[model samples]
Target: MALVAFSAVIPLMTVVNYSVQDIFGPGQRYFIGVDWFREALRDPEVHGAFLRQLAFSGIVLAIEIPLGVAVALLLPKAGWKSSLAIVILALPLLIPFNVVGTIWQVYARPEIGFLGRVLNDIGIDFNYTGDAVSAWATIVLMDVWHWTPLVALLAFAGLRSIPDAYYQAARIDGAGRLAVFRFIELPKMKSVLTIAVLLRFMDSFMIYTEPFVVTGGGPGSATTFLSIRLVNMAVGQFDLGPAAAFSLMYFLVILLISYVFYTILQRASAS
Candidate 1:
């Protein structure tokens, strides 16, 4: 409790304090009530970033969840081969976030990077730094590469938990592969899948580092999601009051959507 208070609660209170004040350096601040919040609500940059964030998170979930499950299904059931595959899948996740960004940034370079050079050579005109669509695609692909292993591992654990008796029963009943998966595996993996979805949604929604490093939140404001917008306001522009207000709103948005996700998934699982 003390650690939580010191780590989260105290900093949160400080943000709360800043959110309502118009600060002019140390000891020159004035109370401004809800002015900053009103400004944040009215900001068009905030609106665009929010929409982009939703789209990114939605696309990520749509791709990674199904792909991860598919990968888990394809993995060797039990062997040294399975161990090797697991280690290989997990390697991407072990890389630091900033390093992941740096790697992709270099890897997507138009002149030098293998992916970029190959695409251009094929006459595809794929420059992530110059094109909005390409930038979005790269960010999404980068996230999938970095994080899908996590989902695959979770699904694999769920798969391993199913009893041999269940498989034997399905086999004796002459259930086909698809039917076994649909009736038994899907139901059994529901809880873990729920967790996977929530984790992916939250992480993807708040993503900043990779996109920032790769696209720097643009060719324009094209790749600018909410987190990037917040950072620009807080650090780039140094608008402390509005930034603080925006941060609080950001926290609420994530918390609210997460609760909604959890509740819906729980009800679906229960039914």
Candidate 2:
């Protein structure tokens, strides 16, 4: 109880306090009601960040969920090979977020990084730092590389949980691969896939460290998602009241969307 309060509750309360008041300096503050919230809602920068965040999260979920499932399906079902594959797939998830960013940053360098050098040599005109499209692509690819393993591992667990009886039944029915997957595998994997989708959505929605380290929200604000924008407001500009309000709204958005996802998935599973 005390630990939760100190770590989460207290900080949240502090943000709530700051959200309604204008702080000028030490001990110089005044209550401003909902002015900051209204301003945040009206801010074009916030709007852009919000939209970008949505797009990024949507893209990530679309790519990772399907790709992860395919990878899980393709994995060897057993033996030493299965163990080795699992270990290899788990490697990316074990890497620290900032370290992943740094690695990609160097690895995508046009002159020295292997990826960048190959692309440039192939005449793709790729430069993550100098091009907005390339920047977005790099960030998305980086995210996919770093996080897809999680979804794959989850789906793999879901796959492994199916009983031999189910496969035997499918075989007796003379079911095609697609029919078996649709009728048996997918239905069986729903619970874990639901978890994978929710986890990926929430994490991608709140992502900051890796993208920030890689792009710094550069190339003319092309990748300035909500987290980056909020940090810029609070830390860069020292707009505590507005930043606090923004953060509250941010929290609410995540909560609301996650609830919607859970409800939809629950209803689907039930049906």
**Pairs in steric clash, model 1:** none
Q: lDDT of each prediction vs. the true structure?
A: 0.95, 0.94
Clashes of each: 0, 0
In candidate 2, list every pair of residues with a backbone clash: none
Given candidate 2, what's the lDDT at residue 90?
A: 98
Q: Assess candidate 1 and give its TM-score to the true structure.
A: 0.96
lDDT of 1 by residue, 19-103 (tens): 9999888899999999999999899999999999999999999999999999999999999999999999999999999999999
Error of 1 at 7 (Å): 1.4
lDDT of prediction 2: 0.94
Deviating ranges (above 4 Å) for candidate 2: 268-271
| Candidate 2 TM-score to native | 0.97
